[model samples]
Target: MKIQEIREIIKLVDGSSIDEFSYEYEGVKVKMKKNGLGNAQQPSQTAIQEPQFANAEEMPTTKPAKETELIKPVIEEQTADLPGADSDYHKILSPMVGTFYESPSPDEAAYVQVGTKVTADQIVSIVEAMKLFNEIEAEVDGEIAEILVKDGQLVEYGQPLFLVKAN
Candidate 1:
């Protein structure tokens, strides 16, 4: 847990023929090893005190020379906590690398959107791989949760295009 303790552990391993050693204290994991050549500088043990055994000791656990700061970042809410958690809305992902087209042409309205109900085998969108336009179909009847990709974007193999909430 502390740098000095870790150094001491390494030193103990280096001084002896112990190839490796590992143990945990109060949920903190520690491990040390000696290389194949056994060339390791062992730390001298002048005085040692186990954390559990020394409750009244006044020594600072971490080094005071190094300034430590804890930081917390703001996070935006995502739908990961929804009922499905790990599962996305039943999606119809891209089968191949291609350009994704929401509509048949530039003039036509997009096929699906958020809350749009889709039937199994419905033509949801098109992916043009190598100049050949391939129809993307929904494999399950569901409502669109989100359109993950934008129109005319280059999609890779197995890339998610739409998120579906099964009906």
Candidate 2:
């Protein structure tokens, strides 16, 4: 399908009360789902699978199994013990699903480190999505207490990126 058609479908889904939608034509498949907040729907996954079979015999007898186990290793537990664990700390959350970048570039210094004081608008990190790098700001004025995610780590939307001791 054309990009315009896909965009129109997204708009339609977003404005309507539908929670999920799916479409398949030819070899292309598109699936969209809302985040359960009754907000705009996001395209969770889009795939184009074209079967290249010269004859019925060329097709495989069984369908490939989904590798759900491989995804488990990507999620790691955060440190359980830290200084001021009992105290109130603000969490800097990722605004979107993307790769977390500590620095603007490989050779550049990180935007902030543990114990680095930051203001509410200070740029703390970058999240690259769809080739666009979005600078994430420290939403609360505080001292960086812990960096939760490693550089180049894949982050999910609303995932905690940093812990901050509010000033």
Candidate with maximal lDDT: 2
Error of 1 at 33 (Å): 42
**lDDT by residue for model 1 over 51-133, one digit each (tens)?**
33233353345432211111011011222233343455675678976689999999999998888899988999999865689
Which candidate number has the best TM-score? 2
Q: For residues 1-167, write the lDDT of model 2, one tens digit per residue.
A: 43324544665776777878888666556676655644457543322233344456644553322222212223333334544655579888888767899999999999999999999999999998778999999999989998988999877666778999998
Per-candidate TM equals 0.49, 0.54
Report model 1's TM-score to 2 decimal places: 0.49
Considering summed lDDT, which 10 consecutive residues are worst modelled in model 1? 66-75
**Which pairs clash in the backbone of model 1?**
11-43, 89-164
C-alpha local distance difference test of each model: 0.63, 0.71
| Residue 31 error, candidate 2, Å | 12
